[model samples]
Target chain A: MKYLEDIGSYFLMLRRTFSGFTKADVLRELIFKEINDLVMSSLGIVSFIGFFVGGVITLQTALNLTDPIIPKELIAYATRQSIILEFAPTFISIIMAGKVGSFITSSIGSMRVTEQIDALEVMGINSLNYLVFPKVIALLTYPFLIAIAMFLGIFGGLIAGVYGGFISLDEFIRGLQEDFIPFHLVYAFVKTYVFAFILATVPAWHGYYMKGGALEVGKASTKSFVWTSVLIILANYIITQLLLS
Target chain B: MIEVENLKMRFGSEEILKGISTVFEQGKTNLIIGQSGSGKSVMLKCLIGLLKPEAGIISYHNKPTQEMNLNQQRMLREEIGMLFQGGALFDSMTIEENIMFPLRMFSNQSRSEMLLRVNEVLSRVNLDGVNTKFPAEISGGMQKRVSIARAIVNNPKYLFCDEPNSGLDPKTATVIDNLIQRITHENNITTIVVTHDMNSVMEIGERINFLKNGLLVWNGTQEDIFKTKNEDVTDFVYSSNLFKKIRDVQNS
Candidate 1:
């Protein structure tokens, strides 16, 4: 019953958050600015880390496939499978959880501790919609942005792999074409969407309930990152097994 | 008019407010005065619906707050304005944006209309030409004035001020107190101000309710405050050294 109630409340918060997209809403600037700074701008660093991790996986696959039982072409195939199916979405979520989760937690927690949230409520404004909803909507939207990030990350790895002679450009291109199934893309989408929701919601929930002062805000921020990261990795493993198996 | 009936609030094991019932008339500064931890602020919060009273009924005019639906609660909330102790201005927004916020949220006014209303409230608060200033850029007194402007911009029916004179110099405190009284009278709104400052009590205590240990011990006008024979009230009223010296001179 509590879970159902929470979902109902979540939808209400979502409606209010989206309703605030007007040019005049107090949170429009905050939501858009956070999306740009925390999601779009972090793309380069995420792509960099994703690219090398992809390369290392490809190299390892190449070394493993040298036995007579496997074809060298399968090395590129497995690399595509890993990146598209699990690696890109899961790793990028962890990165964003560190970035956006901590940001939401600290910002909202400090607002609560400072009585700014209470002030908003007193002003006949819905503080939860003003504060939490933006970040949650941004979280749901930014994962698709991170999906684009994953594609770019994989593209970077493909370029570096061809340059380093780990695989030919033709083989890399062929591997992506051959191994990229519809379910791989679906898995990527599912993982990222769920991760994004978790990353945004956990921090905001903790932050919203935070008390005391600056020290407690700091603690909420730290706890948000820790709990969100744990939940992401755990959820990643569960979702992958459930979806793929 | 605002009426609170048998309002009670408990925070875990501590009973913060104990059956606070009072009526604040329209167009008067209804002051809640008490020392720290005397539940004055808690009573104010309960009246404003910031804290749910464990037992009691608060009515705006004749509508009981507990019976109002969410939309009704929101409507009642829109009719109310609050000036927080710290001003509570959105730190990220400019003064213009802050003042325009409620209009944009609740009113269907056009951009030009909102801007006009915003400018009118700004001028009313004597905050002309500071529209672009951030909350952080303003002085404490100026922040209080801006908060006043924001509170009144909505043309609220009830104004709740929690410590408008707090953390200000005596001169600034007087200015804020005077501003609140002037705004209250101009709008004919029932203004409920919670404070421990006797200076404010003397300046605008048109109707004063004194709380001690979460009970409304004294309810009277400022004239009644000084003229009363109540020892507790006299001890609290004349305890200041300045008032003591004045008393000595008058007696001599």
Candidate 2:
């Protein structure tokens, strides 16, 4: 029953988050600020994780293919498929559910705790729009970040497959171009956009409706991370089934 | 002027405000004084349009708040300023940015003009040259002053403060109280303060409403507060001996 109520409140929060606009000038400034905080600050870690994880996937794939009958090119192909189809979009998002999600929850939750949200409402600003809409618009660039992650993941795989002596550089390049489907990129980005919205809004709901003091803000951030990861994984399953099958 | 007529509010089978009706007039420091759990904060929240009452009327200059649409409510809220008990400054923004927040959100003033107004209010609050500092960088008393600066920056018609001096020294608390009262008179703003501090009550209680357990038990000026013989009145008086000393001095 509580879960059902939370879902209901989530939709209501979504509706309000996009309901009306505040001053465009203020929103523009807020949007840029959010972009810096949410997107730009996240690039370094996303790139690092995407690169290292891709390298590990390549090494693991090469080590498992002990059967000399298997061609070395399949390692590169498997790495490409893993990076683009799942790691870049879904895995990175789950990571962000911890990083960006906690940030949003704590920031907004602290505002709620300290009555800054109430101050905004008293000042006649739509607090949700003023707070969450900028985040939504800012995370519109989430897919762009995912695109960078995809590129970095593949490059890391290339470096690992060749220098680690798992496969020749030429074979890795050839496998990357092997029967590559354009729709998979489309499919990946479609999921990224959906995940981006989930990333921005779910944490916002937790933060905006949260009650209590500073301790509750920390608890709310943890709750936001848990819920965002759960929802993202759930979404990944649903999207993959609908699109891939 | 703000008028509350038979205002009733409740939360989950328990009524927090049991039919409160009163008037808070312009150019006076109207105080709502009660002990903890007396619904003082809830009443302030209601007055600021943050919470809607379950019944009765909250009318601003004869326009009922319940009747206002979203646009109308926004318009009304734009004219209202509030100071939370904790000084609720935006942690991320500097003091200047905090005070300029309302102007940036509501007005289309140029940057220099906004800065000028920000400096004007900061200086009025006696917080000069602290614009670049964040809320965490300031003392509690200065934070309350900055809260006041932010509240009156836009020249709001109604100013509501929830315990303006919760954690300050008595000297600083009196400074804040006097500042609020003076602003009330200078701007002729309809100011309502919710507090339990007898010092606040005695210092700026131009028109005071003494609430007890969700009910209005006594209403009078600060002078009248000492004169009343009612048990509820004397009960609150005995709770704080400042008035007793004044009463003794007067009798002598």
- Per-model lDDT: 0.82, 0.91
Residues A94-204, model 2: lDDT tens digits: 999999999999999989988889888888888999999999999999998899888898899889889998899999998888879999999999999999999999999
Docking class of 2: high
Best by DockQ: 2
Superposed by TM-score, candidate 1 places the C-alpha of residue A24 at a distance from the truth, in angstroms, of: 10
lDDT of 2 at B136: 98
**Weakest ten-residue segment in model 1 chain A by summed lDDT:** A17-26
Candidate 2 lDDT, B46-104, residue by residue in tens: 88878988888999989988888989988888898888899989999999999999998
CA RMSD per model (angstroms)? 3.2, 1.3
What does candidate 1 score in Cα RMSD to the true structure? 3.2
The residue-by-residue lDDT of candidate 1 on B1-63, one tens digit each, is 998888888899898888888899899999998889999888988888898889999999989
The positional error of residue B249 in candidate 1, measured at the CA in angstroms, is 2.3
Q: Which tens-of-lDDT digit does each residue in A1-245 have in candidate 1?
A: 97577557656656665553333555677678767755777777777787778777777777667676665567667877877776778777777777778888888887777667887787667787777666666666766666665666567657666777777888777777774678778778888888888887878877887778888988888878888889899998999889988
TM-score of chain B of each: 0.97, 0.96
